[model samples]
Each structure stands twice: as structure tokens, then as C-alpha cells.
Target: MNVLEIRNLTKKFGDFIAVDNMNLSVREGEIFGFLGANGAGKSTTINMISSLLRITKGEIELLGRNIVKESKFAKMNIGIVPQDLAIYEEMSAYENVSFFAGLYGLRGSLLKERTVEALDFVGLGDKHKALPKSFSGGMKRRLNIACAIAHRPKLIIMDEPTVGIDPQSRNYILNSVRMLNRMGCSIIYTSHYMEEVEEICTRIAIVDHGKIIAEGTKEQLKSIITDTKEIWIGVKKEDALDLEALKRISGIISVRLEEQTIKIVSKAEINNLNWIIQQLIKDQVEISSVEEQAPNLETVFLTLTGRNLRD
Candidate 1:
């Protein structure tokens, strides 16, 4: 079942259109990756979904109810962890969670119980009494998450939830994302970190120039660029490589000699490996190893959008 459905969703800023006729859906139990470079309408779309901005046109449905018309119902079912920390610095960890949970209409013993549960889930149970000002970057990030989940919303939208944290903390949050999905919450996860999205997302959609340019699983997205393949060739002599001649070879799109390895992007259907090796041998380049590089999510993003995720 789809927990969220966006049909012809459009948002504008006077003369500028932020999101243009966007159509998307997030299935229940999916950690859906929503990716776009800066100023690509990604944040604008998210804001509209969270009801932070008024839509200029189209409908956004959260669990079958229109976000604009039935905002109360939508808000109750959706949890948002903004890219910017939404917790109060002076507030104790417990108070922070409780406050956000209370906004969802949780009260009395139920609010306190859910607050503590969220704290424990994020590994900040012992720090419940401590203020967020004293917490580490990762802990604060986790606390931000704790606040969002305290209300136990059916759908969670996490915007850059793992940014600027240590590897351990990032891993912790990634694991927590998976656990949340296991517990029956559909997630809309956006991150500049390609590997994070690649690692955890069940399906992904890439937006560029205010429109979705690609949408699919990692492998499925990679398949869109089936015309090209990347190959890494290890050589004993880097100086002996002929970069220009390699590019001139049939089916080879581009070539680069990096240190002791020659990187080549070529036509996927071309049988030019032997030809490349022969040309390299002619240049007195001794082959050490040859490996074909599989296209990853980052590759797909760059190929489709013509820009890096962080660009």
C-alpha cells in the first residue's frame, strides 16, 4: 500500500516554479530515497509535503487524505526531522521529545511513555536529563530523530538525518532507519550522501530542474545508462599510457590515466577490452590487472542529472 501519493504536485514562488507537475508515491515499509542537488526543488517539494508551504496547484495525499484539506489528519500521521535541528537547546532531552510528541496530541502517561521509548530507541535514554547543548553532534542528531518518532507517526520524512556526523553515528542512524521500516513505518529519506541512500533505500527518485528525472531501484536506475561501462586497468608503467590513442579506439567514450591505473568509460555493448589492452601493450604499458566497474547510484545520479548529489 502507498502511504504517500503526490499527483501533478506543483509549487511556485511568484514567477518561479519550484516543483513542476511532480508525481510520486511511497509504498508502505519502504525507506524511499528522495535525491536532488541544491536548488533542484527537492526541499521545496518536501516542505509542501510537510505542509510548511502552500501548494500553488495539485494534490498531496498522506495516507489517503489531502495534506492541504485534511492537514490535521496528515500531520498526525507524518513525522518530520528537518535538516535543521528543531529541538530547543536549553530543553532537556526528555522534554524535547515530550514537547514534539505532545504536538501530535499525545498526553499524560502516554506522552511520557512514548518519549522515553523514543529516547531509548535512539540510544539516548541515559541522556534524557541532559540538555541538547551538551550533547555530541551525533547524539544531537539522534535526539532530533527521537523527537520526530516520539509521536509514532506512520510516515517519517528525514531530511539529511545523518549529515556531518562521525561514521559510527551515521551507521547508528542508518540502522535505526532500517529498524523503523521493520516496525511498519514508511520513510522518505533524503541525503547528500549517495552511499547512505544507496545502502538503505528500497527505491529512489531523482529530481532536477524542478522535475523527477529518474526513479527506480539502484540497479534499475543504473540500467538507464546501459550505453556506457567503466573499466579500470592496472598498469606497471603510468608514463607509458597513451590517453589520446585510447579515446580514439572504437566504442571507447573517454579515457583517463590515474597514477598506475587507466580508467576508461566505454560503450557497454562494445568488445573493446582486447583492443584497449593491445593499444596499451603497444605503448609499452605492462598490464597488472583488469577489472570492470559496476555502475552505482552515484553514477546513475551524475549520468542523469549532470551534477553531483552535493552540487
Candidate 2:
């Protein structure tokens, strides 16, 4: 079942259209990555879905209910962990969780149990008494997540939950998210970190200039580009010849010599490297080291948009 659906959703700020005719659907128990560069309408899309910002035109349905007409009901089942830390510095971890849970109408023994569960889930069970001000950047990020999930919402939307945290904390949060999805929570994960999305997302949608340019699983998206494998060979000596022959190889598209290094671009289906090595051996061309470059999310982004994701 699709837990969330956005149809022709749009949001504008005067003359600037933050989101344009956006349409997406997220299935239950799946970690869907909403990917984009900075100011590419990721936050704007999240805001509309969370009901924190008004939609200029279009519809959003959560759990089969229209968000605009049934916002209270829709929002009640969704938890939002904003990019910025939303906890109070003066409050302890326990207090912060309790405060946010209370806003969602959780109380008594149930609230206490949920608070402890959330704290433990984020690896902050031992730091329950620590104040936000005293915690490290990672600890604070964990606390922010704990507060958001204390109410046990059915859907969780995280906007760069691991931003600015140490490697340890980032791993902790990522694991927590995977665990939550395993326990039956649908998640909308947005991040500028391509590797993070590639690591965790079941599927991803790449948005740019207020539109979705690509959407699919990692392998599916990578298939959009024909040349998935790149080979680079380092020549032992600049005097070594056969560079022209390498470029003319059946599957080889282009070959360039930079000093003693030979860069080769070829069709992914062809084992061009092996073929190149064989030809070089026949020509007695000196070779140093050979390496294959596998296609990644960054490469896919560049191929489709003609620009880097970080740009």
C-alpha cells in the first residue's frame, strides 16, 4: 500500500516556484530517499507534505486521506525531524522527549515507556540525563530524532538527520532508521549525501529545479546511462605508443593520454580493459597499473543533469 502520495503538488514564493507539478508515491515499509542539491525544493516539498507550509496548487494524500482537507488527521500519523535541531538546550534528553510526546497527546505510563524506547533506540539510553548544550553534535542529532519518534508516528520524514554529525553518530542514526523501517514505519529520507541515500534507500527520486529528473532503485537509475564502467590505465613511459589503436577499439568510445596515463571510456557490456591489455601486450606497450571505475550516484546525476550534484 502507498502510505503517502503527492499529485501535481506545487509551491511558489512570489515569482520563484519552489516545487513545480511534483508527483510521487511512497509505499509502506520502504525507505524512500528524496534527493536534491541545496535550494532544489527538497525542503519546500517536505514542508508541504508535513503541513508546515501551504501548497500553492495540487493535492497531497497521506494514508488515503487528502492532506489539505484532512490535515489534522494526516499530520497526526506523521513525524517530522527538521534539518535544524528543535530541542531546547535547557532540557535533558528525557525532558525533551517527554515534551514533544506530550504535544502529540502521549502521557502516563505509555508516554514514559515510549520516551525510554526512543532514547534507547538512538543510543542515548545512557545519556538520558544529559542536556542538549552539553551533548556533542552527534548526540544532539540523535536527541532530535528521539524527540520526533517518541510518539510512534506511522510515517517519519527526516531531513538530513545525519548532517554535521561524527561518523559514529551518523552510523547510529542510519541504523536506527533501518530498524524503524523493519518495525513497519514508512520513511521519507532527504539528504544531499549521495552515498548515504545509496546505502539505505530502497528507491530514490532525484529532484532539481523544482522537478523530478530521475526516480528508481540504485541499479535502475544507473541503467539510465549506457556506459557504467570506466577504465584507466597508467603507462609506465610517455613514449609508449598504441594510444590511437586503443581509441579505435570496437567498444571503446574515447581514449586520451595525459602524460603517462591513458583514460578509456567504453560500453559497460564490453570487457574493454582485458582487450586493451591484450592489444598492448601484442604492441609491447609498457603498462603500469589498471583500474576500473564503477558507476555511482554522483556519476548518474552528472550524466542526467549535465552538472554535479554538489553544484
Candidate 3:
């Protein structure tokens, strides 16, 4: 079943269109990875879907209800964990989760039970009375998650839930996402950490300039760069090579210098390594080693959006 549907979704800030006309459908019981660079329309789209921001144009359906018109109903079925910490510093862990759960119409005995379940699920049951001000970065992130999931919404939108936390905390949150999905909650997960997305997402959609540039499984996305073998060459730090001239070579799609290393991104089927070597020798460049490499998600992101670093 499609848990969420977005058709022609767009958001604009006066003359600047943050999110162009976009469409996407997320399936039930799947971890959907939403990836993009800073100001790439990722947050804009997310805000619209969560009904936190008004859409200039487009349609969003969550669990069979229109989110714009039926805002309250649709929101009751959705949970949002913002990138910033939403928990209060003075509140105890139990108080934090209970407080957020109460805002969702949960109350009395039920709210109390759900709070305990959420805290325990996040491995913070033992620290229920501890204030968030005393928690570590990872623990605080976990508490942020516990608060978001206390309502057991059908779909959870997590934005950089593991940012700035230790690896152990990151792993715990990733596992918690999987656990939620197993319990029948669909997830929209966004992170700058590509490997975490690759590890957990059943499907992925990458956005740029407010449009979905690519959507598919990890292997499917990598297939877009067919027969593209990255060639790496190491040379002396003082070696001077003509970058523009190298880029002009046939089958050499891109050439750039990373420190003392010259990296060439080219198609393996048509790239002539021998000719490249000949040109290098003529240029009086000392060669250390030449290696062929396969493309990964990072390379694909750089190829599409030109921003490899996650914001």
C-alpha cells in the first residue's frame, strides 16, 4: 500500500522556487531515504508534507487523506522529528515524552503507558527521571526520537535524527528506525550520512533544485552511471598538469586535482588509458600508481548535484 502520495508538489518563496513541481509516493512498511544538499529543496518539501509550511501548488495525501485540507486528520497519522532538538532542557526524559504524547490527544493511563514504552524502546527507561540537560549528545538524540514516536503514528518523518552524535548512538537510532518499520510504521528518513541511508533505506529519492533528480534502490541508482570507472593517478606535489587539456581528452568526462592526486572520471568502455599515459609522460608528470574504481552513492550525488558534502 502507498502510505503517502505527492503529486506536483511545489513550494515557492516569492520569486525563488525552493521546490519545483515534484511527485513521489512512499510505500507502507518501507524506509524511504530522502537525500539532497543544503538548500536543495529537501527541507522545503519535507515541511510541506508535514503541513508545517503551505504549498504554493501540488497535492499531498497521507494515509488516504489530503494533508492540506484535512490538516488535523492527516497530522494525527504523522510524526515529525526535526533536526533540531525539540526536547526541553529542564524536563526529565519521562516528562519530555509524556508531554509530546499528550499534545497528540494521548492522556491519563494510556499516555503514561506509551511514555514508558517509548523510553524503554529507546534504551532510556533507566533514566526516565533524568533531565535532558544531563544527557549525552546521542542520548539526547534518542530522547528526541522517543518523543516523536510515542504516538505510534503510521508514518514518521525523521530529519537528521543522528546528527552530531557518537557512532554508537547513530547505530542505535538506525536500528530503532528498522524496529519501527517492523512494527508497521512507514518512515521518511533524511540524513547527510549516505552510508546510513544505504544501509537502511529500502528505496531512495534524491532531490536537487527542488526536483527529484533520481529515485530507485541503491544498485539501480548506481546503474545510472554505467561503465563509469573512476581512474585515479598519484603524482608529485609539485607536478603541474593541464587540467583543461585533460578534460578535453576523449572519454575523459571530468579531470580535477585533489591535492597531489589527479582524478579522472571517465567511461571505461571508451576511455583510452594508454593515450592518457602518453599525454602524462609528455607533460613531464611523474606517475605513482593508476587504479580503476567503481562508483558509489557519494560519486552519484556529486555527479548529479555537484555537492558531494552533506549539509
Candidate 1 on 1-76: residue-level lDDT in tens? 7899999999989989989999999998999999999999999999999999999899999888899989999998
Each prediction's whole-model lDDT (CA): 0.91, 0.87, 0.89
Question: What lDDT is reached at residue 105 by model 1?
Answer: 93
Best by TM-score: 3
Q: Which runs of model 3 end up more than 4 angstroms from their true locations?
A: 232-250, 254-264, 272-290, 309-311
Please report, as a residue range, the 10-residue window in candidate 3 with the lowest summed lDDT: 302-311
116-189 per-residue lDDT for model 2 (tens digits): 99999988999999898999999999999999898888899999999998998899899999999998999999
TM-score: model 3 vs. ground truth: 0.89
Better of 1 and 2 by TM-score: 1
Clashes of 2: 0
Q: Model 1: clashing residue pairs?
A: none
Q: Backbone clash tally for model 1?
A: 0
Q: Assess the local accuracy of residue 133 in candidate 1 as a C-alpha lDDT between 0 and 100.
A: 98
Regions of model 2 farther than 4 Å from truth: 227-290
